[model samples]
Target: MKILLVGEYNRTHWNLKRGLQTLGHEVLVIGFRDGFKKVDIDIEIKDPLSSRFLKKVRVLIYKFFKIDLLAHSVKKQILSKKDELSGYDVIQLVNESPFLIDLKCQLEILKWLINWNDKTFLLSTGPDYVSVMHAYNKKFRYSILTPYFEGKITNKNFQHVLSYFSPEHKKIHAYLTKTIEGIISNDLDYHIPLIDHPNYLGMIPHAIELSQLHYKTPNLDNKIVIFHGINSKNYYKKGNDIFEQALDLISVRHKNKIEIITVTDLKYVDFIKSFDKAHILLDQVYAYDQGFNALEAMAKGKVVFTGAEQEWLEHYNLEEDSVAINALPDAQNIADKLEWLILNPNKIIEISKNARAFVETHHDHINCAQHYLKKWST
Candidate 1:
């Protein structure tokens, strides 16, 4: 099959591409660099207004006129690839707003792509109308919107995420939900929102190429090393504040037994390498399943503090704190979990082995890719 993966979220598409290729499918990824993450791709979407001069010109044009030059520039870039992008056996968009551009422009570009492609599908791994609305309406106990509802996140800081609830964004969602062949979710966070929808194709776990990931039984000889990686842009959304508060509490209590490492704004390659010496990795606070990073960390045998809620636990038939810790929004709750690991170093080794085994069994790229192949074939 000739597959076209449009857009990427954390290395989701890149991993999927590798899996598909290993299965002898020709896969091409056309996506952006994923900002500071520097995610690799076959073709990168370059920003026409990336330069200081061009950005200034773009801002001035948008300030006076009701037009955004930057958005149009991206739309033009995608549209210009019509020849290269057409006639794939399948084209999967990473999200409703793949390029994070103007909503109307997104609808236009996607509609154009649909006309050219053979079968178009949407992946619900990122923010979309369904997930955002479900969380906004309090369907989940907590979500990325928890900070917003509690007034911890200002509108300016969360405008991008909040955009999914807008009328324009909803229109795009409505169109795609009706037009696309189906929507496939990567994990439980997204799967729960669309399980009953008619076009839902069901959840497929995130693909982690086991061959590429090296698993090591963390050397818990002395101090328990804890690594906290923060993306400055998603500080509040990802519950970094809660993770820090939890870290501070445990830092004082286990000052001698624990070594804390914090890093900010590292690129994708650098960020993954940043936690090599650590036994535990702090991922996200409010989640029901692991994102790409948490899954990747788990693949490397790091006991990750992430989403391992009942839903996830039940799905995988695993006990709590067996493979990964369930990171709740409460600082005290997180701190308690950290304290448990601090006092019980053996438990760290236990979860580390379990984490690697879990990823190998459930998130192996070939298995996940085969799942996608079956879905796309249908």
Candidate 2:
């Protein structure tokens, strides 16, 4: 089957596309290149005019013309790419491209694309509406109370706490069901109403698979190496301060026995490479489930520490303190778990074995890609 994938083409898309190709499907990706071309995928780059000078010019030009024209410029670009849009058995629009934000225009384009060929599938990755709103807004200082602020809200303290809640914007929930044929969510709790639709696909928990090169076991003679995923851009999302506090606590007692590393400063490949030295990977305590980095650690046969949420644990077939050591956002809780692992060699080995097995079964790219193929065929 010939397939067209449209999105940013990040690591997730790269793996999915490659997996589809491995299944004997012709897959072509079209979107912002974003330095992902080195991996092997046909790309069509469409970057918006983002220069500060150009933005200022656009704002001033809009004062005399119209605001909706800015939205139309995006539509024109989408139309230009329609030439390559033909000859595909399936066309999957992974997420909201700039053209899709104009709800009416996107609907019209969808109709247009289908008119050219009927075999087209629109699959949205995740809604993430509230997160986008918060990122775009300038106020509230964009502070996250806990890593779990997965819940949406304006402010914890405000003049009219109840009034600030947006029922209209919250109604964006309905947008998820608007016209999409399928929905894919990283979070099981995203709450889309189309799960019963024959085409509805559910969330897959994040995990790592054994890479081409297997991960080597730690020697234990060296101090425990911890990769702190502190990012300067998404500091709030990553809980930078929380990680720092955990590091400080680990320093006081196991200063000589613990080695901390941050990935933000390194190249992406190099960042993933540093995990080779890690004995234990600390996942975000506040996140509902593990993320990419945590899963990578699991793929490497290293024990990972994460939240104790029932759904997360169940996904891995783990109980309270079994496969992964669950810790809260508190420094003391994280330190205690780390210290316990340091003292108990047997427990680490047991969980390490379970972690690798879990990732192999769930997150293997070929398995995941086959699952998607079944979705298309069915």
Candidate 3:
């Protein structure tokens, strides 16, 4: 089968392409480098004039002539590569707004792509209209929007959620859902909101190339190394403040027993390499299931502090506290958990072994690709 994957989220499409190829299917991916993270893609849609000076000029041009230079450039690129995009057996969009363009322009582009493919699917890799609405409606116990509703987060942090619920974005989501053949989620966070949709396909575990990750039993004889990578832009959204506050208290108590390493705005490759000696990785606290970062660390035999929510645990038939430690969005709870791990170093090795085993059983790239193949075929 020939497949085309649109958009890249934390190398999700890149790994999926590898998995599909391993299963003897031809796959192609097209997306942006997504800034400093530098996600892989076959064809990149460039915004050449996106620098600070150029952006100011673009705003002036748009205000005077109603010409959106950035959107125009992306649209031109898509049309230029129209031939390569045609005749695919299946085409999957990572999200509703896959490209960095005006919503109207994005909808127009997607309409053209829909006509070129036999089947089109949407991936719920990040928050979408339905998911945000669900969170706002209190459909789930807690979500990324919990803090926003509780007044614990700033208005800036809530803007993304507001955008999804906007009339313009709602139109875009409705159009995409109506046009796409099916919608699928890769994690519990997305799966929850999509559960009731008639065209919703079941969630699939993230595809991780197990062979590429090297597993090492961490040496916890001296100080146990704990690492946290911060994306400054979404610090509050990701509950980084909670983690930092917790770590601060824990550090004061166990000054000599633990080594805490916190990095800000590192590139993807450097970020992963920086944690080589870490026994535990502190990931997002607001997630219902582990995201790409936590999954990658788990693949490398590192115990991760991430979302191992009850729903996710029950889905895999996992017992409580078996594999990954569940990190809540409370400073005291997070601090207590970290302190427990520091005091009981032996549990770290056991959890590390369990983490690797869990990834092998559920997230192997080849197996996940096969699952997708079957779903797409249906």
Candidate 4:
């Protein structure tokens, strides 16, 4: 299949591209740098507001006018490459707003994609009308929006997720359901909302290239090292704030027992290396499954405190706190877990080995690609 993946998030599409190519499919990804992560892509859509000045200007305009000044220009960048984007056997959008531009402009791109491609589908790997609506309706016990409901994240900080409820975005959602071949989810977080929908193909485990990841049994000879990496943009949503509070408590209690490293918004490769010496990593709190970053860290045998909810555990047929620590939405609870790991250092080694083994068993890139292939063929 000549697959053209339209967007990326945390190297999602790039890793999929690798898997598909390994299976003898010609796959290309055209998307932005995913902010500071800077994942590789065949065609890059340069972000107009990457600079501080432009971002401040964009924010100011939206503050009063609720407008995106560079929306048209961003749209033009994609449309200009219509020839390169056209005639693919399959085209998959990684999110509802593939370009992360205005919804009105996204529709124009969708229309072009629908007309030019042989088969067009939506990959429910990120926020969309379905998942956002699911969370808003209190279907999930917790989600990325949980912080907002608890009054942790302000309205301005969460404007992007809130946009899915807009009239224009709703129109795009309706059109996608009517026209796309199907929607495939990335993990349990997205899978729950898409269950039983007519156009829903199914959930596929996220593809992780284990070859690029190295596992080391964390050396427990010295002070336990804890690494916390945060993206400033997703600080509240990813529950980094909660993690920080928990870490604060742990630092005070075990000041001599543990060594903590905290870094923000480093590039993807740099971020991976930034925590290379740590025994544990603090991933997000509001997800039901491991994201790319968490999975990568797990592949490196780092016990990650991320979403290891009941659904995830049941789906993977695992025990609670066996492979990874399920980071809930409470700082005190997280602090307790951190303290447990600090005192019981042997459990970290057990969980770290389990984490690496789990990824190797379920997230091998080629196996994930085969799952995608079967669904796409259907």
Candidate 5:
């Protein structure tokens, strides 16, 4: 099959491309590097006017001349690559809005993609209309919008949620859903909201290149190392404050027996390298399923404290929590769980082995690619 994956969100599409190629399918990816994380892509779409000075100039141009230079630039790049993007058997958009440009420009690109591809699919990897509606309807126990509903989040955070629920975005979602052949979710967090969609294909776990990651048996002799990487922008959304509070209490009580490391705003490569030796990785606290970061750490044989909600457990028909520690949003509970891991170091080793095994069984890139191929074929 000839597949073109549009956009990326934390190397998900890049890893999927690797898996598809291993299965003898030709895959091409086109998108920006996704901020400072610098995710890989086959064809690069540069956002050259995103710098501070250029942004100011862009704003002035729009204010006086009613011209959006950034959108113009992005549209130009996409049009220039028109010939190469055609005739794909399948083109999967990583999210509802795959381009960096505004909605008008995004729709322009989507129109071309719909015409060029035989079949198109949407991946529910991030916030989208249905997911936002699900949260607003209180479908999940809790979601990224919980803080907003409780009035505990900032205007900026609330506006982030509003983006998906807005009238314009809703129109975009409707158009995409009507045009696309199917929707595929990468995890339970995304899957729950799209369960009722008429064209929903099914959920596929995030594809991790298990072969690329080196699994190590966690050493239990020295102080147990615990690492938490934070993206400052999503600190509140990710419940980092709760994690920090828990870590603070744990550090005070087990300072001699444990080493707590916190890194803020590191690039993807540096983030992984920084916690290479850590025994436990603290992932997000308010999710119903693990994200790419947690899954990658699990592939490295590190016990991860992340979303292992009962729904996720039941989805896989698992009877145990051997792969990850289910992290709740309470500070005391989080600290207690960390303390328990500290007291019972042997369990860390056991979970580490189970973690790697879980990734191999469920998230192996090649196997996941096969799953995708089957879904696309249908």
Candidate 6:
């Protein structure tokens, strides 16, 4: 199958592309090429004008008047490459809109893509356009109330909007059902039945390399490293403070044994390398256990602090023996678990074993790719 993935080829897309190629399918990715390279797979359809200044200007205009440049770029790309796009058996647009807060642009791009080919699949990795717009505009009180004065405003109405913008509910499920053919969810519960779509898949934000890369594990010498806290300046969803409070509680008892770290200040490679010696990793709060950073830590056989709910764990069905450990989002639960791990180093080692085993079984790039290929073929 010839597949063209339209989105950023960051860790998630690259892994998908690699998986597709490994299965003897031709894969090409169209997006802003951020210095990604692959020999056998990944034909880079680089966007010539995908620049930082252009992106900043686009965001500024959108802030001022909701002008979407990305959608325009995609429209232009599809129009120019109509002949080229006609050859592919499948064309999937991965996560682009919700993260970019440019869903209207993505919607425009989707409209254009639909025009190019009937088989074009909008593989929604996140929330839809309407949801994104709701969240973005609602963040400001002025915009949130703007719909009230203006009568009968459909899109801008201050209603119970979830799924993409808010939380999961019945209405959200129904709304998503009509939006896309399949969903490759970051978390299963958030998307619900949409995940059961014949083509539904799962995603990890970390680079596909994390799943494929070989990491040499050193013997645990009581050096417990905890990487909590988001890139403090980036997104608010990371729940950095949750981890901070947990660490503060643990510091009183095992200050010498544990080292707290955050990569917001460190370089990318250096930050990951710091995790090389880390015995434990805190995934996140407010969502399910696994994400790119958490998965990366698990892949390295580090005991990952993940969610402690049946629904959350069942989604991935993570191996019990690997380095993945569970803790409730509450500071007390997190602190209790850390204290236990500090005293019982043997248990930490056991969980580390489970972490590596779990990642290889579920999150492995080859395995994940095969899952996607089967769905794409159908």
lDDT of each: 0.90, 0.58, 0.87, 0.90, 0.88, 0.56
Expressed as tens digits, the lDDT of each residue in 1-378 for candidate 1 is 999999988899999999999999999998788888898899888887778898788878877985778678888888788899898989999999988667788889889888898999999997888899899999999999999999998997888888988899889989997889999999999999897889999999999988877988889787889999999989988999999999999988989988999999899989988999999999998899999999999989898999899999999999999999999999999999999988888898899999999998999888999999999989
Instruction: List candidate 4 stretches off by more than 4 Å.
Output: 56-67
- Please identify which of the two predictions, 2 or 6, would achieve the higher TM-score against the true structure: 2
In Å, residue 117's CA in model 3 sits off its true spot by: 1.5
TM-score order, best first, reads 1, 4, 3, 5, 2, 6
Candidate 6 stretches with Cα past 4 Å from truth are: 32-60, 63-66, 69-86, 96-102, 122-124, 127-181, 184-187, 190-212, 233-235, 265-271, 314-323
Residues 333-374, candidate 6: write the lDDT tens digits: 789888887888888767766666666766767677776666
Q: On a 0 to 100 scale, what is the lDDT of residue 184 in model 4?
A: 96
Q: Which pairs clash inside model 3?
A: none
| Residue 333, candidate 4: C-alpha displacement in angstroms | 1.5
The reply for model 2, stretches above 4 Å from the true place, is 33-41, 44-77, 96-178, 186-199, 205-209, 265-267
Candidate 3 deviant stretches above 4 angstroms: 59-66, 152-157
What TM-score, computed on C-alpha atoms, does each candidate reach? 0.97, 0.74, 0.96, 0.96, 0.96, 0.72
**Backbone atom clashes (below 3 Å) for every candidate:** 0, 0, 0, 0, 0, 10
Cα shift from native, residue 293, model 3 (Å): 0.4
Instruction: Give the per-residue lDDT of model 2 (tens digit) for 49-96.
Output: 557676676667766764544456656766787777776776666544
Candidate 5 clash pair list: none
Clashing pairs in 2: none
Candidate 3 per-residue lDDT over residues 1-378, each given as its tens digit: 999999888888889999999889999999887666887789998878869899889878978987788888988999999999999999999888788666778888888888988899999988888888888899888788887887877875567667887787888888887888898899999998899898899999888988878899879778989898898877877888889998899989998888999999887888778888999899998888989989999988788989999999999999866799888888899888888888888888889899999999999988999989989989
